[model samples]
Target: MSDMPPSQARSRTKVKPMTSKGTGESDTGGVRADVWVWSVRLAKTRSAAATACRAGQVRVNGQRVKPAHTVRAGDEVRLRQGDRERIVVVRHVLRKRVGAPVAVEAYVDNSPPPPPREAVAPAGIRDRGTGRPTKRDRRDMERLRGLAPKPHE
Candidate 1:
């Protein structure tokens, strides 16, 4: 009984996906922990996020969770990478990976400031022309790294 074309009528009747208020993110229950981490750029890949979860490098609210665990908004996620840890609070849930700029907006980062440059151990550097380290040079390097004991004064 409608005068509109079939395509137009279908479009009009179509319902849009449910989205969270104010945010463009969907509100379909909750997203998986690993997927959320990867979607928000916390981990380079979903597999990496899962690996971190299995390795106990990822924790939710101070408790370790599996990769399939669901992460809801306002949950605190802590991820350990190398010698530093990243702490963030979920603001929005994402089901798919997003760009860096968009991903940054999905979480509230509360990570501690990185250690000063001086606090980190400096790597031994050799001049470009230097063929190889001499035995003495190697000994000095080991001593600097604290791998060799210092001689008694």
Candidate 2:
């Protein structure tokens, strides 16, 4: 048996930085998807993070996930950015904003790029200016525009 100071032994057990590369924290461990989303300037607010979860935009370890899903280093997250989704593995969890690349460093993307195409016009062409919108029409348009998440119940 070898005797060493606990502090010395603990240091050996912990992952450390190398001269050539970062401490591997970004390459090893980091933040959760929702938290990272907030940290990386993905969403405007955390509630938006949760809403993204409910909208089926986030997936973890190959399964769709909830807002509270805990993300650690190496976990993969899939998110719908707009025209396409991004699949990125967690490289680190950062609560603070790093440089854009550093903030993005915590993720890996296997997702394909979106195809370049013209914006498809919305299917239905309902004109609001033709006449004064009825109360129900107003409410429906508001709902479609997401004025309120839940309708009057």
Candidate 3:
């Protein structure tokens, strides 16, 4: 009979190691697509990554993949969240979440830079408690928004 504690015995049990695809060398195997994304800080949560995968918001190597799909190093991953898209080349495969600095090292960002904030026109905002705008006020707001031409005085 073993003298080891039950917890220790369980911990010592051998688990099957996953093999890397293509390469014959045995190392850490491919990580699940959703898990990899979440671990690398691409998504806020593991469930969020899975949700993105299920919603077809995530693509691996240019092909939409399921949450359980495997992802390896050097693969290109594209994630579309709202109006912005993130494109990254997988530099390493990780199954556990890591620090922000370490997470950044896991992927090579290839996404285009976001447009400058100055390029966006500010929305017209009326003062609080102003109630409804008068016809003149409305025309002025429209003109400010470039939706209507200025009226001749």
Candidate 4:
């Protein structure tokens, strides 16, 4: 048998619990749907996050939830960002600022497969063979097409 120093043995304590049991505050088990998305670095702003929920762009447990919707551990979360969509399960709740790596610990991924990246026709635009596009229309078209890429000679 190998013998190690006593100090090293003592330092091997149990993992630190997320919350202090004796204290008034217990660990944040789960968080609001919109809030969790913002906390997990999904949506940029809380307002935008809420907007997504209000617009029915978010779903929980296969049901469309509201902006003020509450979520807890084991609940599934589905959200979309541009062309990519994500599905994650709530593992914890947090309200304060945290590093990206640590913040992700609050959830587990159970995402669905992304749909095929077919050429999407953007709104407010006529066909390619239509009349000349307006300045705004030109910019919009450029942005849409730019989402993919042009072929190189």
RMSD of each: 4.0, 9.0, 6.0, 13.0
Compose the digit string of candidate 1's lDDT tens values, residues 1-153: 799999888888867685655445767578889999999998998999999999999999999999999999989999999999999999999887878898899999999999999987776777899898999899888887778889678
- lDDT of every predicted structure (CA atoms): 0.89, 0.67, 0.86, 0.73
* Candidate 3 runs further than 4 Å off: 1-12, 15-27, 132-153
Query: How many Å off is the CA of 40 in candidate 4?
Result: 1.2
Clashing pairs in 4: none
Model 1, TM vs. native? 0.80
- How would you order the candidates by lDDT, starting with the best? 1, 3, 4, 2
Question: What lDDT is obtained when candidate 4 is compared to the true structure?
Answer: 0.73
Q: Better model by lDDT, 1 or 3?
A: 1
For candidate 2, the lDDT comes to 0.67
Q: In order, how many clashes per candidate?
A: 0, 7, 0, 0
Which candidate wins on lDDT?
1
Angstrom error at residue 16, model 2:
17
Global local distance difference test of model 1: 0.89
lDDT of 2 by residue, 41-148 (tens): 567677787788878898888888877777786677887767778777766666554566766665676778666555433233476678877787777776665674
Residue lDDT tens for model 3, 9-110 = 999889975534422223666889999889888899999999999999999998999999999888999999887899999887887777888788888999
